[model samples]
Target: MSSAYDMIPVLSCENIDKEYVTERTWNGKTKTIFKAVENISLYINEGETLGIVGESGSGKSTIGDILGNLKSQTRGKVFYRGQDVAEMDEESFRKYRKNVQFIFQDPKGSMNPYYSVLEIIGEPLKMLGITDDEEVIERKVLGIMDKVGLSKSVLNKRPDSLSGGQCQRVAIARALVVRPEIIICDEPVSALDVSVQAQILNLLKDLQEEMDIAYLFISHDIGVVNYISNRIVVMNKGHIVEMGRANVVFANPKDEYTRKLVECSFVN
Candidate 1:
């Protein structure tokens, strides 16, 4: 087991930039350029949770998409285990895709209402070519279900039958089924109630400890970020203004926007 001081960075984003361009009708012809992420750089260490907090349109979710290799970066490089993600060929990227997974903010968005929990959780594994060993796959699936506090009894049920929290657990189990080294959680707990949020947060923290997985947790709630993050990165308009230990950044915010965010934080 590695201690806090022995943290190893697994993902590095250097001078990362992205923009969206579209053609519009302005005087019969026009063009628009919208910047989604601007020079955002941060490193996520192995077995550590790095929480990113920013309001809406602050490029929090875009960072998750970029790092998960779901979306390409227009400029700069995203290094996963010191290899440029942009440079990965289809064959090499297949392996990299296995090492990284994403947990979206909306539980329903991640799951399919028409599919049973088993299918939803097992589909990704199947797509990644987990076959010829049915018994082993069942064991792995059940093990992950147990890890997320999900019971086998609910495995046959459709997503609609489960509560929101249970649905989130199923989503989490789905992500864990792939045995990814890192999980990019795009505000996984924000949509749940406070009590349920704590349960999920504890579940994630425990899982990170047990599985040796790193997390890039994105959220707007500083309180939630502080409750779960090892490090905090404050973003504003696609730029990271502050990055440091969670406690240190919360206790002493250097950026005025961060201070305003702290002022708006839940004091209760």
Candidate 2:
């Protein structure tokens, strides 16, 4: 019998690897390669949250970047709706970029400090050729801002002028403006306060429910991952140590690394 993992996912990667050249010998011919992610395979189902958890250097962010097409993997194929992303035509590639939006760990950093919330959120639509009309841009921006719980009054405020929580809400609004099929959230709530984190997480959940958007949620906090994910992927030293239903992995961890993570998260 086939399992949920057998189904073709909204976004999926097979045996992907990412390597970075960290050092070079005096001779240009000799160099040291660092493997940031190794032989990793994962998937995100339609309207589902697939949480990836690992420590700071465990390659979680690298995987996110690769999947979002912000960075390329050194090996393997990434599929969108079962089509190889690398082989896509120009029009198809454009569609992929438009449909796979990203939310970064530092909300304010990802945004242009000089631009107002309206401009920041509306820019993606124009960039993706969705629209260039000012009226349409403003209307869509305001609609998404309202959905993300941002007040209209802050529409003209820049990222520097907003509070951390408000900045994150704007970041989310920007991502949602495109009506993406998937959002790659790379430690999106890590920079906020604990209270703000909960609010942002809840907002993401509500938005996912309403928009039917999938998420590849990457973070170091196992607790946070558990709260938002239907399934979990745990990485260690550039490898996926374990992956399964969130509850099952959290309740009865099978791998040593996974057990350590669960214990650290739940032990008093």
Candidate number with greatest TM-score: 2
Query: Which 10 successive residues of model 1 have the least lDDT summed?
Result: 21-30
The per-model lDDT (C-alpha) reads 0.87, 0.92
- The C-alpha stretches of model 2 lying farther than 4 A from their native spots are 1-7, 266-268
For residues 54-88, could you state the per-residue lDDT of candidate 2 as single tens digits?
99999999999999888999999999989899999
Off by over 4 Å in 1: 1-8, 25-30
Q: Candidate 2: TM-score? A: 0.96
Model 2 poorest ten-residue lDDT run: 259-268
Supply the global lDDT for candidate 1: 0.87
